[model samples]
Target chain A: MLGDEAEAEDVLQETFLSAFKSIDSFEGRASLSTWLHRIATNAALMRLRKRQPLSFSVDEVTEPGNGNLIPKVFYDWCCLPESELMTQEVRDEMRAAVENLPDTLRVVFLMRDVEGFSTQETADILDLSLSAVKSRLMRARMALRERLSAYFGGAASADMEGTRYE
Target chain B: MSEKHAHRDCSHLLAGLSAYIDGEAEAALCAEIEQHLAACENCRVVVDTLRRTVLLYREEQPAPLPEGGEAAPVQSVRTG
Candidate 1:
């Protein structure tokens, strides 16, 4: 969403308007949410692309601001005393970290981790291969691990110490 | 830790980690993985990390959907 509420409103209006017009063309091949998500993602990306100039390689253009898109969170999970473990504050931070994932990664993570959906079900929702779903889920975890490294003491290092979850 | 678990690393168990955490891993493999985790610091850390993450995931309740725009226009809509 744009920093402005009004702008976000406008973008959403345009997206739904376009969706309504082509609603009849949608087949039973995909879930309604999946189809709409595709349209909405396109609309949102198009709006952002217009405002930001992209570099073109051949006919494909890469958006300018994409490279500098920082996540909303930058907190470390470690350094806290064990006394504060599983506090609401920590849970909220973890939720925010999950939300900070990119759209594709977030969707995959939600479907697999949050919803307890099978990899195949998630693949269907995202129109991706099972391997692709697994790959994205792993990437999502890695990103989260980086964000949460302070608390977990870096899984890579912890792993070296034989720190399994049990 | 059991001998089978003590001999395995996280990389070897990554594919089955989620299932194992979900308590869906087979009894034999689970015992082996558990043993390995107790002996191998790296795998133990991986388990701890994933266990904590899964706990966080379980506590996540979706926030209220935005009221405006097409933000979540059709969550209840069934097209099939």
Candidate 2:
């Protein structure tokens, strides 16, 4: 649900109207939720495009009074909790990292990783090829691993201390 | 095991292991993976880490569901 009350109402109304309008083409292949999310995403994207926000690239950073600028750290992989093997902080970091993913990657990751949708379901929902879905997921995971390695140390070493990695 | 033998070259199945753990892998591949895991310590570690990661990934039982209480405009929540 959109947090803004007015926005939520408008979304609800528009969604119903669209559904009614397209009732003839309603195929039962996808779940209602997936269809709704697709509609919502489209609506939301349009709104964001119209009301542009100030752009801030991750690379650019500013320092306070001293004038010595500090570079922003872009490594975000460690934020994802690897497997029930990490501490809460690590898990939270993982969530943040996932959240920070670009819009496309974020959607793909969420549909597959978070929502428990199969690769087929995800590809169908996103209108991406199966290979594209797999590749994107792999890339997203690799990016997370790379970032984790940067922040926490070697990818293989960071998670394995007392424990072992095969 | 020799250094060459110490690392069980299990990265090939690291991803598969996740599926295997979830009982989603093909039966033959599952058996093969388990066989590999049984003999190789290095590969075993990889499996252990990956398994642990998967557990962490799905840590919550019955994860929180969105109530849709915040009702907002459809056209406003940007996807792109």
Quote each prediction's TM-score.
0.54, 0.52
Error of 1 at A23 (Å): 2.0
- Best candidate, TM-score-wise? 1
Q: After superposition, how far is residue A74 of candidate 1 from its true place, in Å?
A: 20
**By TM-score, how accurate is candidate 1?**
0.54
* Highest DockQ against the true fold, candidate: 1
The residue-by-residue lDDT of candidate 2 on A68-91, one tens digit each, is 111122222324443522656566
Q: Per-residue lDDT for A11-30 in model 1, tens only?
A: 56666767778989989697
- Docking level of model 2: incorrect
The model with the greatest lDDT is 1
lDDT of 2 by residue, B1-80 (tens): 33455222544554455456556788988988889867765455444443443444556343343465333333343421
Going through the candidates in order, what is chain B's TM-score? 0.66, 0.56
Residues B1-80, candidate 1, lDDT per residue (tens digit)? 33344322345555556567768778988998888767665466555566666666766675443574343444323331
